[model samples]
Target: MAVVDGEGEAGLLELEDDEPLEDEPEESFDAEVPLAEEPESFGLASARASFR
Candidate 1:
């Protein structure tokens, strides 16, 4: 329900159906929640954190 924008929403949509995320909905939700609430800046931060 927190999916608010096209980019954040699209990432979740793309990853949501992947077999790797089949049971990891919470992970995606957590990442996307902040993305929806914050600006694109936070989205970039989250991406960097994810890579770290």
Candidate 2:
């Protein structure tokens, strides 16, 4: 008959070959990426003039 020590020796050995700790750098966004500009048709200045 085998004895089981409550310390969980078998389970800990399975996770022994894991990855090491290290710092990962952040990702950068380039300014050259094109974005569409808003049109002047829905201008806020003209909308406020109508509310007064």
Candidate 3:
């Protein structure tokens, strides 16, 4: 005697139900924010004195 099963059918249905119909759009950031601000000098005496 031989037996057959359909276990994969249930798994396929579950996967299809879990899938999103449409992808959400990505959010935008502020354009006014400066991205290239120069780093502060730490080793020079003049750089240290400027903070005072």
Candidate 4:
């Protein structure tokens, strides 16, 4: 069994002032690196293979 607490609510209130404005542009999750410049990382090759 687990105990419930009000501390979670308090922490949320503390962070509410730091939240981003709704109008700000959200970041894109797409590749930050250009296809030609991507480093020869291990899993990157397999991941790119699946995309095509």
Best by lDDT: 1
Instruction: List pairs with backbone clashes in candidate 4.
Output: none
Q: How good is model 2 by TM-score?
A: 0.21
The Cα local distance difference test for each model comes to 0.77, 0.41, 0.45, 0.54
lDDT of candidate 3? 0.45
What tens-digit string does per-residue lDDT give for candidate 1 at 1-52? 4456656866677666686667789888988988687877788899999999
- Off by more than 4 A, model 1: 1-20, 39-52
TM-score of each: 0.32, 0.21, 0.24, 0.22
Q: Please provide, for model 3 over 1-52, each residue's C-alpha lDDT reduced to its tens digit, 9 standing for 90 to 100.
A: 1223656677666667555522322111223223222232334566778888
Between prediction 1 and prediction 3, the one with superior lDDT is 1
lDDT of 2 by residue, 1-52 (tens): 1335785765555345222211211111223222212234345666878898
* Residue 13 of model 3, lDDT score: 65
Q: Candidate order by TM-score, highest to lowest?
A: 1, 3, 4, 2
Clashing pairs in 1: none
RMSD of each: 15.1, 14.1, 13.3, 8.6
TM-score of 3: 0.24
Q: What TM-score, to 2 decimals, does candidate 4 have?
A: 0.22
Off by over 4 Å in 4: 1-40
Give residue 52's error in model 3 in angstroms.
47
Off by over 4 Å in 3: 1-6, 20-52
Give the higher-lDDT candidate: 3 or 4. Answer: 4
